[model samples]
Target: MAHITLPDESLPGIVGLFNFRPETTGALQLIAETLLRGESSLTSGERELIAAHVSYLNNCHFCHTSHASAAMAHLECDLSLIDDIKQGFNQIEISPKLRALLNIAGKVQKSGKEVKESDIEAAREQGATDREIHDAVLIAATFCMFNRYVDGLGTWAPQENEAYREMGQRMAFTGYVRYAEADL
Candidate 1:
């Protein structure tokens, strides 16, 4: 059960939070739009992977599954790579730049201050541009906040993986802007 009364119980996780704080949904969507969907050195899939990784680290099942599905949708390859990333990126077959960026993201999930100059340097050395590093950090930090927001509210989350895959297809097709209206 949710910690507060919402307009509907069917709206799961952050969707319920969005409906509860209807005013912030647009702004939140804008942020997500900018970070995950906007043009950047990082592909939409890569950005979503970073988000999914952070959610996994935070143990936020709703976000982990949602972003993982979205990541897979945006990618050209099979979903197993994403599954490996969620488990741990180190042993997975991913780019060195991505690995570096994931390292930084993991650090940020622990604490923003935990991210150091060395981390930034490492990413750059691995071919991550300044913009990529910035975006990765932002994505990590944002997801951490988002994860807490959902869990802190004791929001209901669907356990079924199929729901997440459906959500991913819709999100990949339409983006976050439409989600608030269609779902909430």
Candidate 2:
């Protein structure tokens, strides 16, 4: 149950909140679309991974699970990838650039100032462009806000991973803006 009387109580997480305040949904969705689905050197999967990682660090189950599912959809991988990321991405064989960016994202989840000069240099050394780094930070920061919004409101989420798998496929193929409008 949500802390407030959302318009559609059954809709989980941010979706229910969006229904409660339709006016804010467009801006939020636009931010999501531009940051995660927009043209960038980083793949959508990588962006979603950053979002998931930050959400995980925050212990926001809804954001973590949803973004992890989206990451899986974009990467076309199985649940093992999600498990690897949750267990610790360092053990996985992801690109060095992504690992470096994930490091930055993790630091940002704690505090933006936690990102050090050495972190930026490490990402750059791994061939991460300024835009990619920027996006990674923005994604992390945005997800922090989003995770708070969802969990703070006490919104509900489906317990099963299958629900998120369907949501993930929709997010990956439909994009955020359209999905927001459709849901509205």
Candidate 3:
């Protein structure tokens, strides 16, 4: 059950919240589309991974699972990769640039102040451009707020992975703008 009576209680996580306040959905969806689905040096998968990582750190189950599935869809990989990310990036075979960005994201999850000059240098050394680093930080910071929004409202999330997988496919293929437009 949610903390308040949403317009569609059956809808899970942020979707239900979006229904509760239709006016805000466009802006939220635009942010998501631009960050996750927009053109950038970072692939959609990498951005989704950063989102999943921040959600995981926040212990926001809905955000974590949904974004993880999206990441899986973009990467065309299995759950094991998501597991590797959750376990920590050190042992994974991901690109050094991604790992460095993830490190920056993890620090952002803890506190904006936690990110250091050395972290930026390390990411730069790994060939992360200023834009990529900026995106990573913004994604991390945004997801932190988003995670809190979902969890704070006591929105319910489906436990089954299949539900998230379906959502991931839709998000990966259609993107957020289309969904947001439909809602308007």
Clashing pairs in 3: none
lDDT of 2 by residue, 1-184 (tens): 7889988888898988887887788889888988999999898998999999999999988888888889889988875566677887754467999999999999999999999999999999999988889999999999999999999999998876777888888878788884455554
Q: What residue pairs are clashing in model 1? A: none
Q: Estimate, for each residue in 13-103, the C-alpha lDDT of model 1 and write its tens digit.
A: 8888887776788888878888998889888888888999999999898998888888878875454555676568644457889989999
Deviation of model 2 at 177, angstroms: 0.9
> How large an RMSD does model 3 have?
2.0
Among all windows of 10 consecutive residues in model 1, the one with the lowest summed lDDT is 76-85
Evaluate all candidate structures by whole-model CA lDDT and list the values in order.
0.84, 0.87, 0.89
Off by over 4 Å in 2: 90-92, 179-184
lDDT minimum window of 10 residues, candidate 2: 175-184
Q: Model 1: what TM-score? A: 0.90
Clashes of 3: 0
Q: Better model by TM-score, 1 or 3?
A: 3
Q: What ranges in model 3 sit over 4 Å off?
A: 90-92, 179-184
RMSD of each: 3.0, 2.4, 2.0
Which tens-of-lDDT digit does each residue in 1-184 have in candidate 3? 9999998899999999987887887889889999999989999998998999999999998899889888889888775565666688644457999989999999999999999999999999999999999999999999999999999999999986666888988888788874545565
TM-score, per-candidate, Cα-based: 0.90, 0.93, 0.93
